[model samples]
Target: MWRDHLTQIIVFAVLFLGVSALGFFASRWRRTGSLDHLDEWGLGGRRFGGWITWFLLGGDIYTAYTFVAVPALLFAAGAMGFYAVPYTVIVYPLVMFALVRLWSVSYRHGLVTPADFVRTRYKSPTLALLVAITGIVATMPYIALQLVGIEAALKTMGLVGASGFGRHLPIMIAFAIIAAYTYSSGLRAPALIAFVKDGLIYLVIIVAVIYLPYKLGGWGHIFDAAQAKFEASPAPNDGILLNANNQLNYITLALGSALALFLYPHTATGILAGRDRNVIKRNMAALPAYSLVLGLIALLGYAAIAAHTTPVLKDNNTIVPALFDGVFPAWFAGVAFAAIGIGALVPAAIMSIAAANLFTRNIYVEFFARDASAARQAKVSKLTSLLVKFGALLFVVLINPQFSIDLQLIGGVIILQTLPSVGIGLYTRWFHRGALIAGWAAGMGAGLWMLYLVPNPATDHAHFGGSAIALSKLGLDTPKTLYVGFLAVALNLIVSTVLTLVLRAANVRDDGDDTSPEDYVADRSTERSSLAAVASESSGVAASRAAS
Candidate 1:
């Protein structure tokens, strides 16, 4: 067994290390003498052009978790796995609608974090602090989920055992490499490494879809086999088309996930890093290519069923790894494993940077030391990035590796709370800042309660139980069982809206100080002179060319 897995270990270490080196050196790819400013470290100098953004966002959004967990869910539960595809498909248009405004506003104000936007938008540091804290909390588990993907891949290759520190060793080592380069290079490293991450993932998935089917008999046979297996299952809750309950879960999770996607701090890091509105638009338009790949990858679940591949471990998370093992030569499986392993690095690096930015801009500067220098702030952020990665590593290694997947679900709920502040604030000042705060608190409270009530069968925990809402708990006669996150967010919005009217009627104070009413509608023509000044603040020409 040791000899069988040794080749994979060596390949993964080499590919992963090479990717880390690329990330560390990426700091030089778009070098500026002063890495002191948030522009340089936080947004990769806000200058990635269309091609780089596509690869970076592709690597950012479609992660190792997508590669390993989605298929595993499909193999284990059936149709629920494809939720990722629709969510990715719908996310771009949603991002396109709000991102330009966010960029213009952020550019105008020199906002480094989403909390900076919230702080300025609402004119309330407390509210912005909540949003910042939520982002960091939500993102931590997401970084860990990438590690879970690596763990699943390693387990399939027989590199580790099911329990104890042995199972965690691989994740710890991966996290160490991730933490090291991220500490040294900041956001540029991940942006540079994304090219390799996306290229490998694309090659592996494309080849798997075409090659696996031929090896497993044809497309028709694969479909037939999958249908037969699902049909023969004793559970009524099986198959691709969600029943009334799963359908609601599917739609809500997708929509809620789409809304939450860009709200995550790392996503904000990517969008703000773009050179201009055009780069943002072009990237948004082009990013669905990853979604196309995601749709193809989701079909691999059906392929797994056709191959009659049994998951090697106690859990079915090994479906994709096992499928590759069954069909590919061992050496090729090593290459596939490299794809999954390196895929974790890009997002992990980005998330670490985003979290560090939040701490540097919001907490360190705001409270700890208002007079801190930019160079000192950069040093603090760099260290914080390493700590964030290290914390995520501890979560995976100490808790259970599987918990990261569950925690990621919870992260979605936590991140969704930021939408009314970040997403809704983009188009309107109608929401009273105080009322918005009230709304966020209510939404976050309810979302957590609902998530807490749902229980996972595998772990016997309640609250975020499976995606389905048990109608039995609600005590109503309805076929529509909704996603907990959707319901919680709805509750949050209602409470916030009602409170806004009351606050307005009482003539309570609102922070209309930070942004002007006309600022939201300012296009390139009206805003050009002001925009040019903000763009020229530092490293303007190099930033412009890279973005161009």
Candidate 2:
């Protein structure tokens, strides 16, 4: 069977190796100075212009999950899978200006991670440590999910025969390559490789959308097939239409995802790498176009059903890849497989680098070596990245793939808890550090408990089932469920608000803010001391006091 797919295997190897070569070459792509500094290695010297930043951010945000897991969701869950589309649509407009402010303040302070921002904004090292730890923990499974995206494709191609260790060997080899380039080149590896990755994705998607529909009747027939399949199912929620029971869950999932998107350290890494506020602003405006593509991609699930394509190993994640292999010529199917493979590479690199940056700056340098030079920090970050990727590899090897999925779901909920501390902290210093920590603790507790209560009917798991939970769990008298992230964050905000009042009234001694109101507004164009020379080199900053 593997021998039958040799054409595809060769094509995939060629493209995968080519990108690995490009990853090594990226170290020289934009050589401002030595790659010794964390600023240079971890953040690409923070000099990415409009187009480069556009592709890099696109690569980071629209990952292999976009290609595999999302469509897989549509294949399995019908309309609920479509939530990714709306959440992406909602995120860009919301963060367009908000992130610009974050960029400005971070640029001014030479901040390398969101934890660094928290540390500076509240003058709380303790809170910064918490933020950094959350990022590293959250990213491990997120990276493992990326590997799943690739493994799904590999299995579809018949490259990995049977199951067990041999099935994952190719993935291990690919990540070994990824780990090497990432350690050597840092953020530039992903930033540069993103161009090739995005171009391939767009080409495959365009061809699939137009060509697949023609081959499998029309759009009308595809929908009819999907609708019939779902209607015949015994599941309570599996139609093209969103029923009343799941409506609240859908809305809250979308909104909560939108709010939590940039709060992830990897997303922030991409945004912060922009050369100026204008680049980020332009990107924010233009990036919604990906959402349109995402919706089209989700439709491929329906196309697979219309084509009567069976998933490899009965794994829904392999549906899109299986669809391509079943219908398209071997050559084009290989191309599609390569797209999914490269798709995994770009984001995995960025995520490892982002997590590494958090450790180097927030934990390592902050605690162990306060006077650590930028070069020393960069070395630590490079090593940390390898460890992070290894941890992700362990998740794939030792754990059930289902737990990887659940962990990613839980990862979003876990990261959302930081939004009040990092996302809101960017615009306002209104909340006390003690209150932020307490609020964070409460949100983490509630989010974990809610996730524990969720059960997966598909897998027949009794706990840690999924992201949505029924209102009855909270003593409400309805069948309507809400996103765990959405509910936990509301509880987080309430505790933060009430605690802030309590702490302020008690005159609790605050560490005070290290950032001035002007830090958000002033850029390199306008001098704020010797720092203005560095800040003016690029552009990005929000007004000191933006309206909430």
Candidate 3:
């Protein structure tokens, strides 16, 4: 079965091995004095500048799943999949306002994780611990979603085994390579490999959008074909054009996703790695260019329909890869597959590093090893990253890809609950720590309950059918659907507001904040003295104090 794909496989092998070499050697690219510190190992020394920041953040935002699953969702569900394009558009402006403050404060305080910032800002270890654990739990399934992208590409290339362990071995081996390099080079591995990954993705997307459209009888024919297919289908909301029932879902999903995207620890890991606030600002302005690319990528679903390409596997995630294999030459198809497979590595490495940093800085150091040295923290982070990656590997292997997508939807919902404390708290300390904690709990519980009630007929699952929740399910008279994250977050904000006022009236003691007003606006150059002083405070001392 693999004999016919030898050319494609060989080309993919060369590119894969080349990037693997780069990942292993990335530690030497920007030589820091030591990789013992969390700053050095977990965040690429926080010295990434304009172009590096652009590519790194781009790679972090646009994952293998973006290439595979977004198009797959478009192929399977139509207009709803285009939610990602607008979500990307909406996110940059939001980040421009929110993340610059976060970067300034994190840089000023020498904070390594979002939970670390939460701990200091709220002066409450318990609240920060919730933020840290949410980040880890939300991140694991996201990492698993990236593997789904790789699995889809491999299945299209006929590189996967027939069943059971044989089918999963390729995925495990790929992750092993990623885990090894990430363990050695840490964030630097992804930071460097992102360049190649994004380059290939752009090349493939640009060519496919231009060439495939012309070959498949242009955009008009593609849309007509997709529309015809959806119109004939029995599903009410699966058509090419957005209906009244789905318009709310589309808007809310896009906006909710935009808000949730930056809340994940990996997103912050990318932002925090920048050299200064200007690096973040400039990249935010320029990063919208990827949105243009993403819009084109989403249209590949329609293109696949126009091409009359059937997914090689039962999974819709394989639709784009199948389209490539059927239409493009074997060698070029190989390039496209390589783009996706390599794309997984960049985000997976960053995510595991982010999750591991959260575990090391927020949980392990805060609660378990108060006297742990810098080197000890780095060692723990490296090991934890390995465990996180393998855990994601197991998740993908054991569960279905459709279920993985549902979990990712739940992940966005789960991570959004942190906005009250992390994103909103960046601009104001108005939210009491206790209030924020209660809000997170309320939001999380509501989100999970909604997800549990959604049913996916395709997967024969009763819960976690999708991210869209029906208004009728929420006791509304209308049949319209909306993104569950948005509703849950709204509930969270209301609960937080009412509780903050009540707590203040009752004279509930606030956990006095550690951050000064000036800290929120401090930059790297302006805050050199403060950064130096904070850096001098050993991790052990900080952890011990945080614990006490």
Candidate 4:
């Protein structure tokens, strides 16, 4: 099998190496005066135009997981996997309202991470630390998910062994290349490489969607084959259509995931890289084109079933790669695998940069070095990105892939806890800082406990089985299942609301906000004055401390 796939391996290597070279050279793409500044190194100098922003955000959002795991889930479960499609669709309008405001305020205040905004909004270092830590923890498994995508591709090409050191050596090597480029180029690396990654993915998906259906008879036969397989299986809920048992899970999962998607630090990293609020608004309108591509890609799960392509490693993630290998020519299969591999790089780089930015801005700057300069912050951020990527590598090497998936689901749950503080706090300061912190704690605790009780029989794991919880598990007798994140966030809202009222009535002091109402509406052209003012204040404070 390895010898037969020599052509595919060659093609994958050429494309992968080509992108790594591009990533190294990306530092010079925009030709900044200084790469030492945190804004330049961590955010591509915040100058991405409409088209660049479109491709960068598209690449950041539609990841290798979209290419591999979504289809894998579809292949294994049927209609339930299509939740990603609706989730992507639901996320755009929501972010259109939410992120534009976040961009304006971040640009105005020169904030580098969501936690930076949280700190300024609440004037609470502890709350910001919580937000920053949650972001870093949530993002680690997500980065591991990307590595899982590349591992699936490598496994499909027979480049890695079934177990032991051989299995992880190739993954580590790939991560090392990513870590090097990201350390050098930071956000620019991913923004530049996204063009190639998105282009290859578009080409591969276009060909697969058009050619595979015709080759396998038609879409009709594809669905027919999927239904036949599900019917023959012993599983109770395995058909191509949604049943009453899964209806609530489908709706709640889509809603919860959509709410949590942009809350990830990587998504905010991409959004903050835009040149202005209009760049964000335009990208929001245009970025949905990738969702259209995603809808078509989801059909490949059915295509895999129609082709009767047995997964290579008994892993569902291998289903898509195996489908390409079975249906397409060797060279084209190689292209598909390369697309999946390179797709991992864009999001991995962004996620690491985002996590590093959170650590540098929120933890380091806020706690250790309140007087740290931009150059020093950038240095810390660069080193932190390398550490974050290696942490993700350890996650992939040490944990079961299914467990990583569950951890990512819990990540979404954890990240959603921040919406009350970061997302809603953008518009209103009514929720006290103490209330927001308590709310986050409630949501995170409930989410973890719920995930711990759900069991996966296939893996024989008694805890952290999956994101879906039976309604019966929550004291209802029905067999229906719902997303754990949604239920957790509901409890989060209740706690925050009740606490906000109690705090207000007790005359508790909420930290005064640093931002004004006008800041949320500020555009790039109007933001410089505020940025300059903040910089002057920070310098003065540093000098005063030095004099003392």
Estimate candidate 4's alpha-carbon lDDT, on a 0 to 1 scale: 0.88
lDDT of 4 by residue, 156-249 (tens): 9887778888888767987898899998988899899999999999999889888998899989999999999888876644589987899988
All candidates in order of lDDT, best leading: 3, 4, 2, 1
Candidate 1 regions off by >4 Å? 397-405, 517-548
Q: Candidate 2 — what's its lDDT?
A: 0.87
> Model 2: per-residue lDDT, tens digit, 1-548?
77888888888889988998999999998879889988888889889999999999999988888888877777777888899899999899988877988888988899989999999999899999999998988888789888988888888877775577777886687679889999989899999999999999999999998898889989999999999989988775568888789999999998988887888899989988888888888999999989998899889888888998887877778999999998899999999999999999999999999999999899998899999987888899999999999998888776555423455677899999998999888788899889989999999999999988998888777888889999998899998889999989999999999999999999998988999988887555464455665565533333333432
Weakest ten-residue segment in model 4 by summed lDDT? 398-407
Q: Per-residue lDDT for 80-136 in model 1, tens only?
A: 778888898999997896988888888878788899998898788888888888888
TM-score of 4: 0.95
Off by over 4 Å in 2: 402-407, 527-548
Give TM-scores for every candidate, taking all chains together and pairing residue i with residue i: 0.92, 0.95, 0.95, 0.95
lDDT of 1 at 405: 49
Cα misplacement distance, residue 528 of candidate 3 (Å): 4.6
The deviation in Å at residue 262 for candidate 4 is 1.2
Decide which is better by TM-score, 1 or 4.
4
Which regions of candidate 3 fall more than 4 Å away from where they truly are? 528-548
